[model samples]
Target chain A: MTSPQAPPALRLRRIYEVAPRDLDRAGTVSTEVRRELLALGMSPDVVRRASVVCFEGEMNMVLYSEGGRIILLVKEDRVELLFSDRGPGIADVDLASQPGYSTAPDWARELGFGAGLGITNMEQNSDLFKIRSRVGKGTVVRATILLGVPFF
Target chain B: MKLADLAGLLGAEFVTGAEHAEREVTRAFAADLLSDVLAMVQEEGVLLITGMTTPQVVRVAEVMNMGAVLFVRGKYPTQATVEYAAGAGIPLLAASRDMYETCGLLYQAGLRPAKRKGFRLDLPSGPARPAA
Candidate 1:
């Protein structure tokens, strides 16, 4: 086995273990991540955008897929989020990214979310956005926001 | 107006965060939908007015870093919701007034709803300096 690596100076300050497929945990994770980001010197505006995007993504994983992990990385200039999961992959990337497009179940909609706007909001908020997926495999989303970028 | 004033005006009772009554409130939003709240409200000192009382309400408050939550229509959220807010350090309050009445009272008190693209938060960037 390889030697373990040291925690980066600017690294994830908080780690939350959420049950796979637990939608309720989505909100809790979002709240804590936002708090940690703020404490790391991220602006409120950026933190809000990140929090919303992250929460929506987490909910998606719980509702549609087999659940996953949301890793928040705090860097000197930006906060990088990595969402990884092992679940059915997005068959149509373009369609999935479209605003108002979602595969969330009925229960998710009743809670006032899963409007297909989750990914759209994430795209709009983050300075950089990327997604990798494969059929019957899983999906990985990486989003980054500059620390001081004006969200308005 | 502060949360205490709004609570008193609406005759609402506190579920938690009674101590935060002294905190200043600069804005407010009325929506039961979490998506709209996420897309619209961004001010830190916002008073979220919603009829929907669920864990999502507290979650919304947490993610948005809202000042306080005022549940309209006299709806009181579950104890779990209250506990969630308390743990998250968010203020939670309940109001018996309907959505319209609650919004009117807050509006009359100069707590304007944010109107901007993405989200609108009207606040000074820096601490206020004492007048010379």
Candidate 2:
């Protein structure tokens, strides 16, 4: 998840795993991520934004992927959330990112997921965002919310 | 408005976190779709109105920092969901009224709607103003 826009370095925290089709455990990882961010005394704005991003990514992984893991990266000047999933990867990232566009299954749709807003929401809340996917291989999303930025 | 007063006005039964009655919320975002909630709720300390009563409802409120959740149409969350909300400090309430009347009462009682992109929320004055 290296990027020129990211700060010089970051301390990696725990990696949260999202299980496939586990409606019972869907929100677990996002809750844990929120707890850790709160424990670290991160700003409320950053924590809320990060948690929303994490929860959306977690839900996407659970709803569509075989499974996935989210890694928390805490840099002195920013926080990075990385989601990598083993799923039937998207054939079109651009098409997938469009609002209200989703390939989510019926059960997931009934549960109010697959709004097709997942990627867009993550991108909006995040100061820096990137998604990389190989059609048959998998997908990865990295969202960074910078801290102490003057213009933020 | 205080959560307790809002609950009382709506005749809602507290499913959890009655102790948080004193907390105040001046805005609300009403939606049964969890993703819509996630996408649109940008304010903390607001009420979330929904017809869904699954644990996911509470989870969404928690992540979004909603002050409390109001379940309409007589829906109620499960035991585990209530317990989870208690632990998370996000209160839950269930009202017998359907979504339409429930939102009407809330709006009439002064809980403004949460802001949305490209949508103006300002209620114009005069004859056009919605009756309380």
Candidate 3:
């Protein structure tokens, strides 16, 4: 008898790649994704959670990374976000996740972000969150927002 | 409270979306950080009061489904910001009062803080729930 084959991975309905150059561009990308999610009939609370997660991830990429890409995966029951950047990776993920701790430059503060709330905000808004980094390599963040359920 | 009422209370200048001046504002939230606003403001039709003059303010309102944005401390939005708000149908108002004063006046006028439903982490334990 032939061995049973594993099930195929879930197919994504849509994928949006946003490269944020600055805050304005970041806002644009976030807004576009939010619109798409809402159009898919996701609950308002769920969409808001996804929007915040996306915005924070986008801003972090623009601020720290040389430039990175935000990949939004629209699945049937959840929205998955992957933020990958090729920059000086975090030496301590635990320390970086702490609120009120920041390595952002002065310019980032002038833009009204870099208050050290980016990662915490992302964690708070996402149901399933993970961060992987290696010094001198890069950082990748994955956040998942389950659909249909109200976030509140 | 009506947008026009809140405008009069703050002595705000309507830069755009005058057509929506009469829309009701169910709640009010004030913050400079866009992330804080996104995380805290839970209700639709709430008024956003902020000191930030960047276009991201309007974007926040649009993404969060806010009723309108009231710029404080005499900060007027740029033309591009006004155009964006108008295009999105979100009313924009500017006031000469500072953040504290704006909140004070709005409170005096009976506008209350939006009751935010607490944020919850819904961990997937078993099978994925069916989509609604």
Candidate 4:
């Protein structure tokens, strides 16, 4: 039997092929997506939060995973984000989820965002969060947010 | 005082939000952490002073809906950062003064961070919670 398919709203709206080596580039990609989402009339508040969460998630994927793609899906009622990679998966999700838990290389911390708030902030900002991983295989994170009525 | 006036006073150059240069500023807060800035900043008219040069700085200002951001100690932002601020339409300023001195200068000039209003719980004369 085939597994159930994702809803149409969960389908990818944009797929960004970004180098998973530079956190700054990842942030730029995240910003570009958010600008388009805002232009599409998404709530400003939600867009801001989602942008940050998505940025941190993308950066984490780059720093941790071998490399991957960022898929952004927007719907009338909600937005869904998916990050997939083929790097070694998290051994202890609990520890990683902790506010200050970070395996980021020291160089990243010097860049000012590796304070270990990546997962914590993502979870805090997103309404629905899921992390799936298999040792030596990879990890995928899914985040969803309920869209608010746009003022415009 | 107007943002333009402050910019001139600090010998700082502008990046964007020039239209708001004449808008009055009433307060200032300097910080690198977005969470702290979000919790402490008063509102729309406050100027943010910080030394941390990062794109998230502009993103935080966007989220907080701040008036302007001044990078103290003559810290110039990278080209990418300037572009980000310009894209967001947030006024970015560069000042040679340190954070403390910048805050002091602004404070002496009559700009102050407004106190945040707290929620009030009315007493005996107050209306009770409505039943669901």
| Each candidate's interface RMSD | 6.2, 4.9, 4.9, 7.6
Clashes of each: 0, 0, 0, 2
Ten-residue stretch with the least lDDT total in model 4 chain A: A3-12
Residue A95 shift from truth in candidate 1, angstroms: 2.7
Most accurate candidate by lDDT: 2
Collision pairs in model 4: B26-B112, B27-B112
Winner on DockQ between 1 and 4 is 1
Candidate numbers sorted by lDDT from highest down: 2, 3, 1, 4
lDDT by residue for model 4 (A1-152), tens: 54456444433388877566765665665677677777887766677667766777777776787877778888757787888887778888877877656787776666555566677767766888998888798888998887764421
lDDT of 1: 0.77
* Candidate 3, superposed: residue stretches over 4 Å from native: A1-21, A149-152, B115-132
User: For model 4, what is the error of residue A72's alpha carbon versus the real structure, in angstroms, after optimal superposition?
Assistant: 1.1
Q: Poorest 10 consecutive residues of model 4 chain B by lDDT?
A: B115-124
Kindly report which residue pairs in candidate 2 clash with one another.
none
- Tens digits of lDDT, candidate 2, B1-132: 998899899999888889998999999988877878877887788899998887778888998899999999888888889889999989998999998898899899998988757522222333565788
| Winner by TM-score between candidate 4 and candidate 2 | 2
Q: Write the per-residue lDDT of candidate 4 for residues B1-132, one digit (tens) a residue.
A: 898889877777776667778887777887755534543444565678888777767766765567888898788778988888887888888888898888877888888764445412122244677899
Model 2, position B107, has a per-residue lDDT of 96
lDDT of 1 by residue, A1-152 (tens): 53456433576644555467565565677877877877877666777888988877776676677667788888766788888888788898878877666776787677666766667667777899998888899888999887766654
Using TM-score as the yardstick, the better of models 2 and 3 is: 2
Angstrom error at residue B17, model 2: 0.7
Question: Taking chain A by itself, what TM-score does each prediction score?
Answer: 0.85, 0.89, 0.85, 0.85
- Give each candidate's fraction of reference contacts reproduced: 0.50, 0.58, 0.46, 0.02
